[model samples]
Target chain A: MIETKDLRFRYSDTLPFVLEGLNVTIKRGSFVAILGHNGSGKSTFAKHLNAILLPSGGKVLVDGMDTVDEDRLYDIRQHVGMVFQNPDNQIVATLVEEDVAFGPENLGVPQKEIRVRVDEALRAVGMYDFRDRATYQLSGGQKQRVAIAGIIAMRPRCVVLDEPTAMLDPVGRREVMRAIHDMNRTLGITVVLITHHMNEAVDADRVLVIDHGKLLLDGTPREVFSQAETLYRADLAVPQPVELIYALRRDGVDIPGDVLTVDECAEALYHLLKSRTNTRG
Target chain B: MLKDISLGQYIPGTSVIHRMDPRLKIVLTLAYIVVLFMAKGPLSYGLVLLTLGLIIVLSRIGVRFVLRSVRPLLFIILFTAVLNMFHVDGDVLWSWWILKITRQGIETAIYMALRIAMLISGTFVLLNYTTSPIMLTDGIEQLLGPLKRIHVPVHELAMMMTIALRFIPTLIEETDKIMSAQKARGADFETGNVIRRAKALIPMLVPLFVSAFRRADELAVAMECRCYRGSEGRTRLRTLKLQGLDYVAIAIAAVLAAGIITLGVVLP
Candidate 1:
């Protein structure tokens, strides 16, 4: 679990604060998505989770260990893994299995144990078959999956991913999302996914909207997307289906604004049309 | 064209030579180079050649593939051989204008060329063709471990080498993309004189260097997130343990050096 108390940060004294007076708590084994546009301080917030960037004001505590404690830095990192946007830059090894083993190796895990963790991690991410393949030769999706595997190999209690699918294609995005969901659901690892894609947040247990380093909205996806006007004011957009429903509601079509998926939107429209036809009959 | 750039000439295989401990292979390669220089006459060179041939056979990497390592240096090899042919003075085998060919000069030229070629082939067969770049760096780090006591950053150097090796292909790919992008924007790279051609690459190099630095920064952060603190307390998944075959390899190398030294002493 991660808890941030009035977490505030700025790259330097000359620059303004990137994160300003934000307080949030990420629960253990829960999937949470942090949505924000570019320069919204979401990434700065994620960086503080694992102590990659210390907060200039207030504090970030991971499993009750303060991020500013120099002695517990590695311990905090090992407990909360991080995956970055660019998959190519993050992978340390040329080969697939070796890259996955990199985390455990850095932790000084025993040789036999590292191998088991590497294999298990690769299998969990569906990369076991490509374990011997070269890392660069893989497609974008496969490489991102390998990056996720590298993180999970350390057996972290929580993972904070900063726009992991930003550079990926649609298919790659789906593959990465599926892998993220699997880690959260099957392994019971807490996931804090920072993404601009509203659809990616639809499946999360909680959604936190960050606007100018402030927590603008914090609720379930349905509750957050229902307030489409506020999201637009924050320079964010709801998922496509939710956007459609929002538009229909604005036009006085009496459609629900809480729809988050295509299937749910279609079913709601179908029922509305059936009722209209029944009234005419 | 950039896709063809191979960082290390590693030919993966399950052969005993490929499976040998990389530390042993690196030490043996150094010994092989030393014995190669110690060789003087045809008998000693022939012994070295025989040993190299045995290694090539055991590595299971085809001879033609191994010879590719020497192909890039063909011009230098021939230039040295030709210089040796004319520089040495001895009994004249022939004469044409200022070029007088001596029997000793011809012998030396042939020996020199053969030595250079065999030395390259021997190393290619033993190290590059068998051990992966990661394993090679691992071997170097372990071999240089003692220097750490003298304040040498051997692990850091090896880590740098491994990271550089990992990024070569990625950087090459980026170069290709930048080249194509420049070409699309009407930039010329191939149609001018040497200076013009060199100048055209400035646009390409600038972006490549910028992206590379950015990648380095991001990679450093990623490394820290995975608990990488330095060489201290870090363990490797693949620990190099010397097998029986590795000992046999070292023994053979020792005998080869001994044979070459004996041939030098006895023949002269």
Candidate 2:
């Protein structure tokens, strides 16, 4: 569980605030998708969750510990792990299993326990077979999964991934999302996925949109994507299906504008046509 | 072609030699080098050869693989053999203008040649052909652990070594991508003089350096977020605990070294 209240941050006094007066709470065991255009403070907000960058203004609490407390830094990090954008950058160890075990080793976990956690984490990400393989030998998707496994090995209560799939191919993106969703479903680990991909947010339990360091919108995928005008103003777009439905509605066709998936859009069309045929008969 | 280059020459196996502690393997390999040089007559060299041969067989890395590791030393081995065959003076086997091959010289040539081959093969058996680079670095770190008391920063050095080794392949791949991209843009790296080719690389080098720095910065942040305080209290997932076989291997190595020195004094 993570809670941020009136969070304000900036690189220096000369620069404008990157994140200003942001307030949000991420519940335990829930998947949250933070959607925003580039430089909208989604990533800056994610950093505050694990105390990577202390707030210049307000408070960030992980579970109950404040991020500003120097002594609780390690505890805060252990509770909330972060995966950055570049997979190649984050992997510190040559071997996959060793990289996964990196976090636990840093926490000073015993060797035997670390071994167990490494195996479990790798398996959870579907990368158990590549445990002995070199990190460089893996593809982009596999590398990102290994990064995820590295975070999960820390046994964090929550995970914040900063545009993790931005650099990945479509298949790699799916693999990483599957791994993240699996962690949330099975391990009950709270997940905050910071991404601009509207389709990626479709599967989340909730979505928070940020615009110019301000909280623009917050709701479920249906509620968020339905506000196409608001997202467009923020320089973001709705998922394709939602956009298509919204377009159809504007063209004088009666259809649901809140549809988030292709399947849902197709089913809605089928019902509309079937009802029309019945009325004509 | 660069992509095919393997970083470590580790041949994966479950052999007893493979399972030996890397620290012990490193010490024993150094000790074996000393023993090879101390060997004097046929008996001592024969003992040294036997020990090294046994290790080679136990490592299960194959004789050809070990022999391949000696390929780079061929010129040196030949030069030593050729020099020792004619330079050392004793009973004359043959004589030519400024080149006399003596019976003593012939014996010395064969001995020196064998010593060089055995010395090189001993390294292959204990190191390159068997141990992974990371494990070899780990071994070095543990062996140098005492140096930390003398303000050596051994752990940090080893961590740097491992990190460097880890990034080599990643960086190579990035280089290959950049080279291809530049080539597509009419950046001719080939068909140029030495300086011209070097100059052509400036474009690739600039972007590569910039990206590498950015990666390093992000990696540092990621490492910190994982609670990496330093090497002070960090535990290892694969701690090198000395097994029973390691003790046996160390004892055998000590005996072999002592036997070689004693035989050097005793044998004619």
Candidate 3:
């Protein structure tokens, strides 16, 4: 589990705080989506999780290890992997397999075992076939998957992705989302995904919304998306189907606003229409 | 036009030279260059030219392509040839005001041009046309690995080199995109005076620099997150090992250099 206590941070003494007095807890092996707009401090919060940035006035503890402890810096990082935006920038090596081997090689893993981990990580991300290909030649989505493979090759207990799909196209976005979901479900690796995309957060076990450097909301996807006004105040929008249901409920249609997916919305509408016709008969 | 710069361009092949270890290739290329400078008289030059020609043919990197590699150096060759043609004093063949051409001048000019051309093509054949840049850097790092005893940071330098090579194409593509965008905005990069045009590039440079710095920061964080401390206990996927072909290539280079030096003493 990861926990932050009264987390506070700012760039300098004179600047306004980017994050202030924030506290949250994340369970082990759970997929959580951090929701926020640009400059809402989501990325800053994610950085503090792995001790990439220490809080100015608070503390972060990852799995009972204090992030501020100097000796446990590498220990904390090894447990929490990070994948950043810009797939082109995060890739360190020219070759796919070599990039995947980077993390393990850094940890002093044996040469033979490093190969095994690299192959496994590539397979996990569904990029084993392109193991020998040059990384620069790959599409954005494939490159992002290779980055994920690099992180997983270290065999971390948790992974944090900071807007990993923001630079990708629609197809690439879906491909990356699929890989993240697979990593969470199959490997049971705790995932902290930082994204503003509403649809991407729908499947997450929990969602934490940040607004003006404060935790504005925290709940499951269904519970969180139900609060349309709060998301509006945060400069965010509800998922499409939830928006539709909210509009219907405003028109006195008695539809629930908790629907997070299109299929659920369709099923609820089908039942609503059926009841109305039976009452007329 | 910028894309025409052929840097570290490796053409994959199955030639005997291509199959040699990259370290051996580098050492041999340096030896061949030293010998080319030592060569003198018609006999040594003839032997050096004959050897280079045979190696070119054997490497299978066509004569036309090798000559094309020399195309960019045309200006330097012309300058050297022209300077040599009129500088050497001997029996005058032609004289006009400050310019004088002699028989010895003509001979020296021809020899100088041939020497420069042979030097460039020899290095190109070994470095650019055959061995890949990654292999070259790997060989360099291995050759310099012992310098770490003196605290030289060999691994860090090699890693930086590899990363730089990897990002060149990416940065080029980015520059192309930024240029087109600026052009579409009627930024007028072409029709301005030198200073004005350079100032016009400020817009492009600013964004590129910003992105570059951002990329460097994020890459540092990502690398640290991956447990990269230094070269302390790091291992590599591809290890450099010298083969029998490498030994033979080195031997050939040594023999050629010794022959050239010996011929320099005996001839003329």
Candidate 4:
């Protein structure tokens, strides 16, 4: 489990923070999505997860080991691996297989094991074919997958992707999100997806809303979308189906349901139309 | 690795030098250097210079690139000339108080300058213009393959050299970015005293060094990830092969050197 208590971080004490008084807990093996508008302290909160940014006050722990402690730093990092926004910055190796093996190698894994892990990670991420290819030649989606494979090879219990799909195109974004969903479902690895896209967060198990450096709301995606006022107050938005349902209900349609998924919304609409047909007949 | 250092600085061309086998090119360069020292007076030096200039022209590399390569050594050239200017004791052609200009001094200065320029330009033709560093180092390693019997780490050294060459541009690019970023943070590297300027570079240098170390660490991890376990049984993807043209080229260069050496000494 990842836990943050009263996590207040500032670049310098003389200045105010982009993250303040943030208290959050992430359950193990759960897909958690953190959503907030720009300048609402979501990115700053994301950096604090892997001890990339140390908290000025309070504490952060990855599997009971405090991030504030120096000896537990690498362990914390290994446990809670981070994939940065820019795919270019995170990838250190020219070759795909080598890039995948980076984190495990840093932990001093033997060459044979590293080979196995590299191959496993590449195959897992569906980038096994591009193992020997020059990273410069890889497309943006391929590059981001390579970066994810790099993090995956480390065997982190929790993978924190900080807007990994932001730089990608529509196709690239879908490809990356599918990969993330597959990793979460198949590997059972807990994923903390920090994104600005509401639709991306729709399928997640839990949603946490941050605004002005504080936790504003936390619940399941459906439960959270049920409360429309909170998201609006936080300057955040809901998924497409939820937004459509809310708009229809606000337009005097007697839709008394919270719709998170497209299929769920369609089913709800079918029921409403059927009832209307019976009443008219 | 840094990508802009021009270490893999091969300019693709259909010139004779570019087409020559790398190993043969290495052998020819060594032989040429040896012959260059044998160059005695005006006739031999003139032949060497003319031959190099011809090759440079054929290579189609810009004069500016060659000049840029030599620019770093300008101080050394000037120093050697200045030293020879004062130190060479010979026929005193003229004297202006302590600044005496001798006939032999003038000739020695010109010869030294010409020798330095010819040596650099010729090698630059082989290295910077014609062949890439990776190929060059590979050629050197292959040529020195026999040293493996004597327990020389020729492969390892060659690998190290290639990596160093590869990272030159990467590091330069990193440094450029760091400088720009630090400048954005209002760090002034220009318009300061020597100490102040040095102090101002702390932010830039710190980040650059951090990034370099980070890259090195990451590269090491990546290499280990790829199952790289030193110079034991690695095979080359692009093995070097010598063609008939390579032998003919080397033979031609050998004969040219021989003819020049013979005519310079015996005829003189």
Q: Using Cα atoms with residue i matched to residue i, what is each candidate's TM-score against the true structure? A: 0.97, 0.95, 0.92, 0.60
Share of reference contacts kept by candidate 3: 0.74
Candidate 2, superposed: residue stretches over 4 Å from native: A278-281, B84-87, B91-103
lDDT of 3 by residue, B1-268 (tens): 5543323568778898788788878878887888888888888898898879867987899998899889999999989999999999999999999999999999999999999999999888878898877788888999898999999999999889888877776777788889899999888888768999999999999888887888888788888999898899888776777888777766776777777877866766
Model 1 chain B: ten consecutive residues of lowest lDDT = B1-10
Q: Which numbered prediction scores highest in lDDT against the true structure?
A: 1
Residue A185 miss distance in model 3 (angstroms): 2.5
RMSD of 3: 2.5
Best by DockQ: 1
Order of candidate numbers by TM-score, starting with the best: 1, 2, 3, 4
Runs of candidate 3 exceeding 4 Å displacement: A14-16, B1-7, B89-100, B192-196
Candidate 3 has an lDDT of: 0.89
Q: How high is each candidate's interface RMSD, in Å?
A: 0.7, 0.7, 1.0, 7.8
lDDT of each: 0.92, 0.91, 0.89, 0.78
TM-score of chain A of each: 0.98, 0.97, 0.97, 0.96
Pick the winner on TM-score between candidates 1 and 2: 1
lDDT of 1 by residue, A1-281 (tens): 89999999999999999999999999999999999989999999999999989999999999999999999999999999999999999999888999999999999999999999999999999999999998989999899999999999999999999999999999999999999999999999999999999989999999999999999999999889889999999999889998888888899998766688999999999999999999999
Q: Flag clash pairs in model 1.
A: none
Distance (Å) between predicted and true CA of B187, model 2? 2.5
As a whole number from 0 to 100, the lDDT of residue B236 in candidate 4 is 36
